[model samples]
Target chain A: MTYCIGMRIDRGLVFMSDTRTSAGVDNFATSKKMFTWCTPGERVVTIMTAGNLATTQAMISLLEERSKSQEERDPSILRQSTMFQVARLVGSTLKEVIADSSPNGQTSDDQFSASVIVGGQIGEGRPTVYLVYPQGNFIEITDDTPFFQIGETKYGKPILVRTYDKEMSFEEAIKLLLVSFDSTVKSNLSVGLPFDLMVYETDSFDTSRQKRIEQDDPVYQSISTGWGDALRDAFQLLPSYSV
Target chain B: MTYCIGMRIDRGLVFMSDTRTSAGVDNFATSKKMFTWCTPGERVVTIMTAGNLATTQAMISLLEERSKSQEERDPSILRQSTMFQVARLVGSTLKEVIADSSPNGQTSDDQFSASVIVGGQIGEGRPTVYLVYPQGNFIEITDDTPFFQIGETKYGKPILVRTYDKEMSFEEAIKLLLVSFDSTVKSNLSVGLPFDLMVYETDSFDTSRQKRIEQDDPVYQSISTGWGDALRDAFQLLPSYSV
Candidate 1:
């Protein structure tokens, strides 16, 4: 299990993903789930994946290999003209991987299925985010729903639903995502630190703001502990119920 | 789908359950999920259920009918010697209902399966809570885990995990639960308003502190709105991340 957030704010796109993967309780490993492909001043594409680790890795590998080869037969994700086309390429590749892994064609609940969050800017297009499903279908973020969360999402959702603001700065957005991710990490065992984070400022077409937040990162530690105390204090302030 | 919670505090026990039950998106109805049986000054038992509506309803009806009959041919939940025994009775009744509803004997994932949270005091026994599985087995809540949530439990769990205190007063506990339930109601269509609440004081052997909070209830409305504002303020108090 994994937890990933792809948020589209007025400033740009903010993405965060947990890096814990487990085949069983005894067999756990750290694996990066955030992938980035940028063409410097032209385009920046970021993806966060959740579900079957194998399926996600295979899908990402195909995209990476195709982009490196000059063969026109294999469409490169970097070659897509728009963010929508990039999302389509990602969805189809994910579908292809799942279908190839399963003996029978992939079902909606196939064990090999994976979902992806693709978000970034292409040329002069507006920055956006899309939640690509395992079935090769996708939906872009809207003003009403400015963020997308996939995998182990519930424990951390209430805070996001209440606190998300589209006009938030990249720093504030990272703070918000970290708080959300901290809630998830505390409540669920499958999603653990260190988390991979990427902040793509619209029109920058660069991925230099990417960072891996380790378990002992000072800022993350402070936010994690501080948020818990803040929550308890907030709970204390609510009006009490009486018979 | 449903959301129900049974929490044990030093003051005694607190229970809250949402009443929205739906067969499909277009088909929904209000139904009680909390049930209680008490012999004043002697014993009191409360059960909150989640899962297949038919299974839970049948199980509750069986308990109600058997407890009303004086015949020794059938066991009565009211006659249970202790709260533990009451939980066992509830679990077996739930398992029996699921078995009867399905053609083959019930499986762990059987659609006819249901789970129950039973808590209260019997005779001189201490008030306690038990989470009964669909397999007719149950585990009593300990000091380490003083609450039990059944069905659609995730969205509302972080708040409980962060703020729950065994020494909390009944008023504070109820306030905490309402906040948790409000989160679930706002996020899920399967769980909604008009929540049922029950508070049992230890050794009281009474179930009088029960109320159905309607959607338009003033206190609930105030808490629902106030909590969102409080949470946003809490988010702001956290330290901002810097790139």
Candidate 2:
């Protein structure tokens, strides 16, 4: 299992994802889930995946291979005219991989299903984020719902629901996301540490601001410890339930 | 849908449940999900239900009828000598009700199934809680996994996982529970206000400290607001991520 979040605020788009892949309790590995496709002064695209690792990795490999050749694939994300077209390409690529992986007609939909969060900018096109489903379909995040979370979302959601702001700074957005991820890490085993975080400012079509938060990073540790103590203090301050 | 939780602590057992029931977004109603049967200084039992409302209500009605006339029922909760037996009785009863509700021997298990959290003291038996499944089997909460939650559980679980203590005060437990319920209520419509809460001190065969917290309850509102503010503050204090 994996947990990834993509938020489209007034400032820009924020993408974060945990890198824990497990086949079962005994077999676990660290794998990157966030991929970037960018041209310094032109476009920046970030893709975060959750669900079947094989399908997601295959789709990413396909996208990377196609993006390298100017004439190889007609619908490569690099050639897509808009963020919407990029999302459509990713969704269709994911579906194609799943169909190819299954033998005969013996594919269980749940076994091969995966979801992706694709967000970025292309030239002067609007900066946006989309949640692409396994069915080769997708939905863009709107003002009414400015965020998309996939994989182990509920445990970390309340904080996001309460604190999300369109005008939040890039720093504030990263802190908000880390706190949400902290909640999920504390509650679930499937989602672990070494989160990949990237913040794309609205009109800056470049991949300049990103960080890989690891297991023992001082700031991460402080936030995790501080947040727990704050919760305990908050619990104590609440009015008690009496007879 | 519903959300109910039962915690077994050194000081006592805590049970909290919401009262909202909904078939869909357009059709929603309020319904009680917590029930208690006590013999004062003898044995006391509390049952909280989630899943199919009809199956749970039928099981409860049948148990009440049998407790009135012991000779008519073979495995009534009132006749059980231990908490384990009591749990068995509740699980079997729930299974029976589900089976009885479906016609033509063709029942979609998901449609009629219900789960229960049963906690109490029987004679000199230890005060504990068991999560009774729809299949007439149950598992007791141990010191490691000291609580059980049914329906819409993930959103509220982080606080409980962070704050639970074996020796915390009942006030602390209730405060923790209300915070958990508040998180769920904020994120989901299926779990709503007017929460039913009860706390049972170890070996106490009476239900004394119980309350129904309504939508506008002053204390409940304060906790809800206070927690949100505390989280925002916590987020502000966390060190920000840089490029």
Q: CA RMSD for every model?
A: 2.0, 2.7
Per prediction, the TM-score for chain B is: 0.95, 0.93
DockQ-derived CAPRI band for the predicted complex in model 2: medium
lDDT of all the models against the reference?
Answer: 0.91, 0.89
> Could you give candidate 1's per-residue lDDT for residues B85-172 as a string of tens digits?
7888888888888988889888877989889999988888889999999999999999999999999999999899989999999999
- lDDT per residue for candidate 1 within A129-227, as digits (tens), equals 999999999999999999999999998888889888889889999999999899898889999999999999888998899899999999999999998
- Most TM-score-accurate candidate: 1
DockQ for each model? 0.79, 0.72
**What would the TM-scores of all predictions be?**
0.96, 0.93
CA lDDT, candidate 2, residue B85 = 89
What is the lDDT, from 0 to 100, of the residue A124 in candidate 1? 89
lDDT of 2 at A241: 72
The residue ranges of model 1 lying beyond 4 angstroms of the native Cα positions read A66-75, B66-75
Off by over 4 Å in 2: A66-75, A101-109, B66-75, B100-109
